[model samples]
Target: MWVLTQKINEREDKNFSRKCLLCRLQFKGCRADYLSHLSRLHNMQLGQPENLVFIDDLLNCIETRLESLHCLFCNKLFKNQTVLKEHMRKKQHKKINPKDTEFDKFYIINYLEMGKNWRQVKNEPDDDDDDDELSNAENSDRRVSVGNWSDWEEDEDKVENPVVCLFCERSSSFDEIQSHMNNAHGFDFTRISVDMDFYHQVKLVNYVRRQVYMGHCPYCDKILPNRRELLEHMSMESHFIVPQMQLWDQPEYFFPTYENDSFLCHLNDHQDDMAELHLSKKMEEDCHIGSC
Candidate 1:
């Protein structure tokens, strides 16, 4: 899918940084620190810090809302600030609502994808998550290691940027991930692509990635309780196969299931080579006809 780059909305004042509007003079110097505080303390993430614009204004808006005894996530009004705080804490409503497009202006993606909101980009027919943190907060009952503020900052990057095997937790760099998938999981994406178009291959990979990540069997509806058991079930049941096209074929699959899995970027290059080969054969055929 071709994105019109020149048309993406422009953002400025990215250097703006000041004291946290919510906290008592915390995060006074760096915006990155401010963002970490929000994520760590409040569980609030207004998208990624790097992709944010007018962040101070965004925080001010949120603070104003809070000062009025309102919940940021639900936007529900309360009789007092103490009541609102309790409501947000009890309901786990510390973050902004993803469905609310009013907050879209604060994110750079809304501008970058030709003025399309990031949510819209996910929903667009050409490309898409239930990618919130709350559901998989503990990585589906994995042991939790409570860490310091710096550790908390590092954890988010690791979670979003992992290049782990689709069937297991083994990780490698982007260049090595495909090889790992093939060697470790017996899943060779390139070999499978000889019979399918690029987009179909994308979908198939996404289907498996999602199912296996969620601890479910991609070939069937059978669900496992966790990643460990799911791996065993798939291996023992011999149930790895392309799922129903209707299930996996989606625009959202065009996106990497993992944020930094640059293997998805490699698929574009793979398709280009096939197209080049086809063009070369056609050119040779034309040359022979001309000589004749």
Candidate 2:
């Protein structure tokens, strides 16, 4: 009977500790202080706050709310422009996501085999023009005869920019093309290509071919199921507009500046720091339990 009573009292004490001390109208303390006050004053056993589920969600919410923020992907917290630039080099946001597309692949393969030497000057094929000379030459080459080039040439004028990316070969405007190169193929466009054949051939091709790409918006980090959804995201205010300048330019590659004001620069750093600490504490607790 004594043991049963003791057990019941213990459960009651635990439940009392779990209630939010500052949650009531009478008390208006923050979560940490209220929890601490309850444990210390009422001799209550502390447990996790009911509202917070995963630490990531809590941290993310807190992080967005703060005034000065850090890059979530990079550890660099930005109070100013100088700090942000330092972060970009160290964090290398360009490297994290390779924006490879199907069109990039076609462009790269075709560019490697056939240089950008030919231009289709005429829209109409002249019946009197010499098809026999080109056909005979093509027929002589054993490997080149594999695919129908004439059929490809007929439709080629419809497509702009045949220079296929090793990752995607779609005809994107020049501004968007570099992003495809960096994100999908893992080619740092700024770096000088040491081995032209290797860059166009083995290294770049192997980089993206090995991995399965689910296309994501570079600005919002939203992974869409299809290209249509990605296009919709690109048009919306939430997504970063691809700058008119070359993608390799520091302004385009680093800070996503649609306007003079920056959203990332004005993030909540303190809240993010606090949330990270809280998460670290929880992880430590979990690890301890697991190890034991």
User: Which tens-of-lDDT digit does each residue in 94-184 have in candidate 1?
Assistant: 7778787778777667776665677777775531245434467567454355435678776544533345666777765444776887776
Candidate 2 per-residue lDDT over residues 56-158, each given as its tens digit: 2333332352225444343446654334434542333311111222112212222323333112222336677675356755666845655667877776444
User: Which structure among the candidates has the greatest lDDT?
Assistant: 1
Over 4 Å off, model 1: 1-162, 173-175, 252-256, 269-272, 281-292
Residue pairs whose backbone atoms clash in candidate 1:
9-111, 127-251, 127-252, 128-252
Best by TM-score: 1
lDDT of each: 0.64, 0.36
Candidate 1 global TM-score? 0.40
Q: Compute the lDDT for candidate 1.
A: 0.64
